[model samples]
Target chain A: MNVVDARQAVTRAHREEWARVVAALTRRFGDLDIAEEAAAEAFATAVERWPDDGVPPNPGAWLTTTASRRAIDRIRRENRRDDKQREAQLCYDSPPEPLGAIDDERLRLIFTCCHPALAMPTRVALTLRMVGGLTVAEIARAFLVQETAMGQRITRAKAKIKAARIPYRVPSAADLPGRVSGVLAVLFLVFNEGYLTTGPDTDPVRQDLTAEAIRLTRLVRDLLPGDGEVAGLLALMLLTEARRAARVSAGGELVTLAEQDRGAWDAALIAEGHRLVRERLAAGTAPGRYQILAAINAVHTCVRDVRDTDWSQVVALYDQLVRLDPSPVVALNRAIAVAELDGPEVALAAVDRLEPDLAGYRAYHATRADLLRRLGRSQESRAAYDSAIVLAGNTAETAYLTRRRDQLG
Target chain B: MQYLISVIHDDSTLATPDEMAAIDVFNDRLQAAGHWVFAGGLAGPDSATVIDNRGAEPLFTDGPFLESKEHLIGFWIIEAPDLDVALTLAAEGSKHCNRKVEVRPFR
Candidate 1:
């Protein structure tokens, strides 16, 4: 290939191996900002030099080694003029080895980014930017927030880490359980954003976001075995994600669970989720929220059709979940299950309790409208639909609500 | 070893009656397991009176410790073998309460 073509190939290769390379480099260089800078510099250096010297046999390893050297060089250069740079210089000079040698380092990075010390929004932004490799603008776009706002969030998070002197090292074995759960919560939120996209232009089914969440969860599970919650979360996400294809119609209208085609669900993910849920249950420990949610999803996935779903069992699980993690969101979900098991009127009352907390949440209003419509309260249903339409983020959901309102009219 | 698992969050965010009853069910499980020592959901932080009796006349203050977004929501004293077991129970409390739970050994 020509020089231009070779450079293009190198860039592609770098993008493909970006996570592994950056992760290994981050272990060597403790600072995320410095590690990222070094990794970029290494990739750029390769694009310029690889055309003449020929591509390395193991490009990821070469990039990692090169990034470590570049980090050391930068530190040394800074140290020449400043005494304070000496500590950083020492850290870079004897950087940690690659993945096999530093099993816990990447997990530490994940935990640090998702640290409970930081706010929820900060945790999500930091995780996506640092681990998911999403650009600031992309993350801003994903959340429907201004780019400047997202940038400030990330900057503030980094500052907090530095100011608090939060070490980049992995947590001790004693602290691992708590820290790991925090990391999983971050990833799960990221996936939820994709799975339930409320953006005006984009489809509600965010396949890319869902896929990334699944991949990260799998990576964490592999690194830490016998982590029931990790497996539970992965299973939960997969089971939910399996229904993506049938979540909405080709016309971009929302399809309720009962109407969706069972065949369209991803059977592979379903099988994997089932296996994990079973394994976690067999561990003989109390089920966490993730495990409970996974079990709930498994119940849904295992049913032959939506009508066949064990609504009573689902209601029981929701009862347990509401007890386990009593969020307004969980209450709204439980209300839906109650609607199926009991009647729309009972569910409507249950949903009413959530109105104070979920006033701004579109799904809450949308579900309320459905329950009202089922009870033949046409005017009330239309009003509820109107609220949902106003709060709805995505075009698909807005359109779906609009149709429901029209039907009521 | 008994450790105290203290629920700490904004006083305004206290769980409602239904939610509190759910927590009662969780404590029931713990009690059945023989890990529960004593647990109670506290009233608002302002209801707490801090007394400093070092002076001739006792000085009194209206609220709980720490002036911040967080407050002492509630707590449970449970017996566990070590920090690991204590933390596991703390995690359970945090999850069940849907809030932060600080696990500290009883002095």
Candidate 2:
């Protein structure tokens, strides 16, 4: 390759290796902002020199080493007058003795980004920014928010981390279980953003988000062996992701579960998900929220076809889920499941009970409309669909409801 | 080393007696593992006493050193290999009581 091609390759490598470099540097430096700055500087230096010198055999390791050295140099220069700076310099100049054990730097970074001290929205923004390696503009666009607003959210999250003195280290064995839930929640949120795009195109934008979430969950499961919930979460994501291919139609319309093609689902992920859930269940522990949710997904994936789905078992799982986590959303899901398993009239009753709390949620109205349509209440169903259309944030979902309304007509 | 696994939280929202008994069961487990040093729930922060030794004469206070919305409800000093192990034990303590546990190294 020519010099220009080599330089382009070097630039691409730097961008690709940025996350790994940042994670390793953060582990060494124990400061997210400094690690980020040093890693960026290392990448800039690599861009200027790597093309001329040729790419290193191990680019990521080289970037990590260079970033650590850069961080040490910057700290020494800035803290020349402070005594603690001398100690920090000595500590950095001689790196810790390399232990050949597998370090969970990326998982630690994820936990730090999803620290409970930060607000949930801020946590999502920071996780995407630091761990997912998405830019402010990308995240802002994905969430349909302003770039400045998203940028400020990340800045405030980082500031909170510093002020709270949130440890950069991974949680202890006992704390790991609780902490895992928060990390999973952040990853799931990221995946949902991409899996259900609210944009005008009416199609999912970044399937990579769902893939990344599964990857991160797998990392967590590996780091904490015998963590059933972690395994369950990974299984849950896999089972849900397995259906992604059939979630929308050729015309980019949302397809309900009963309408999706089971043949198009990723069988490998479904098999792996079922295996994990079975293993966890056999361990003789009471199921947590993740485990229960995974079990529900497992049931959904087990059917020969959507019509073969055991709606009764699904309703039972939703019952367990509501008992475990009494969220409005859970109740909403249970109502739909109940409608499928029992009668539309019973489901309509459950929907009526939920209306006081779920008046603002678009899905509640859409679900009510579906149940009403099934019960042959055409006028009520149309009114409910109209209400859902007004509250619907995503264009595709609104279109799906509109189609359902037309079908009722 | 005997480490203090301080269970800090608001006293007003303290666990019930049955919950406290459950915490004792956890403490028993820690004892069986030979890590439990001592554990007890404290009264409200208003019952605390603080001594200030900065001046010529040491000043004494009737209540806690700092006034805050969330006060240290209780503490446990346990023996463990390191901070990591101590933190794990502290986390169990927090889980049993459904509150936060701050594992501070005793000087």
Candidate 3:
């Protein structure tokens, strides 16, 4: 193989087999540091040797074997000879199962990474690194965190998992339903980080985090196909992703729903999103927060014109969502729809009540600013816009708010 | 693997009769399941003393090492294969004792 082709194959193999190699190593060696380092070394070796030797027929198995050797070598070099023989016996594990077994291994790695014992951010960082096969630098860049600090967080998390003996197994049946939501939460956070990435210097939209989140969520969905929330999450991501093209203007400012060009939205993603939403609707099961939210997005995407949108259906979905999650954020979103249906005066009352809870939330301020502007209270609206612009983290959102505030003149 | 499930409380209130009954049942279940290793409640932190001996002259303190509103009132060291089992047991223990619990792995 040519050098460039060999390098591309190595990259593809790293993406495909990193998690499997790491998961299998972790199960055998029972050490995150050892498993992660060994997998990385194996990939590095592939880069060095694949150009001359050609790619292996079964890259996953090849990577796993190389990684196991690296791990065992490290064990011997570290003078842990007492564990060497015993660990070698573990290396002679049952023959690798088909795809189903690989899925289970990935599931275990994911559940372990998303364990509730670890803090939320720790779970996100670890999941990205271990399960998503992302580098520490890449993850840190996505979240706008210092690489050193993010590295330490992942290090401490791995140590805790090892010391605490966080098992490399999925939650039991009873725990699965509740715990899957936690896993979904981490994935959703990754998706949102990509969707409306923060900071001035960073890209307003981080396709990497969003794409990774969708990829990982799809993996979870496949692993737990019967999960409604998982389906709902996937649907929600697809619907949101469908609008990605039109969400930002040519100037890189966020285009509100009312202003985005309908022509720009991806038809295929919208169709897929609509199908998932419809499947859940036909299932006759009571919807969860994500399902209801996806339904709401489906409503928004189903329409070709902003003026043709069904305000009542959107508001109804938000009402259903409020029952599931009575957070101020949901209430604030509901109020936005309320503005369209019940007019700004009524929506303003609801938005104002959420102020105590969402005082610092940029969207809350932006919503309030829009409602006040509709009521012809330009001065109050301008002030609300100011608060929103200041609090806005995403460059696109900030620019959008700035343009809106200027337009109040 | 073993987890130290520390029972935490904000007040000096001892377990009520009902709570003690529940704890007994929970402890019995843990024993039956082979998850029970050791479990006990402690007196108030006022009964504890702290001694620092790292210095040349050992210093003695009359109270707990750190005085805080919430303190460890009891604990259970339960043996389990992994954290999931340990966490579920800790949750049950917390419910039985009617107090918050924290789990930490022993090195």
List TM-scores for all candidates, in order: 0.73, 0.73, 0.94
State the lDDT at A195 in candidate 2: 73
* Higher-scoring candidate on DockQ, 2 or 3: 3
Which candidate wins on lDDT?
3
* Chain B structural similarity as TM-score, candidate 1: 0.87
Top-TM-score structure, candidate number: 3
**Lowest-scoring 10 consecutive residues by lDDT in candidate 1 chain A?**
A93-102
The chain B TM-scores of all candidates, as shown, are 0.87, 0.82, 0.94
Error of 3 at A154 (Å): 0.9
> What is the clash count for each candidate, in the order shown?
0, 0, 0
The Cα error of candidate 1 at residue B5, in Å, is 23
**After TM-score superposition, what is the CA distance of residue A176 in candidate 3 from its true location, in Å?**
0.6
Backbone clashes in model 1, listed as residue pairs: none
Choose 2 or 3, whichever is better by lDDT. 3
Model 2 scores what on Cα lDDT?
0.78
**lDDT per residue, candidate 3, A244-328, as tens digits?**
9999999988999899999999999999999989999999999998999999999999989999999999999998998889999
> Model 1: which docking level applies?
incorrect
State the lDDT of candidate 2 residue by residue for A19-67, as single tens digits: 6777887776656787878987887787777767887888888888888
**Model 1 agreement with the true structure over A107-194: per-residue lDDT tens digits:** 6667778876679889888877776667789889888799999988988777656544344655666677788888888889889888
Candidate 3 interface RMSD to the true structure: 4.3
Kindly list the interface RMSD, in angstroms, of each predicted candidate in the order they appear.
Answer: 11.1, 7.4, 4.3
Task: Give the TM-score of chain A in candidate 1.
Answer: 0.88
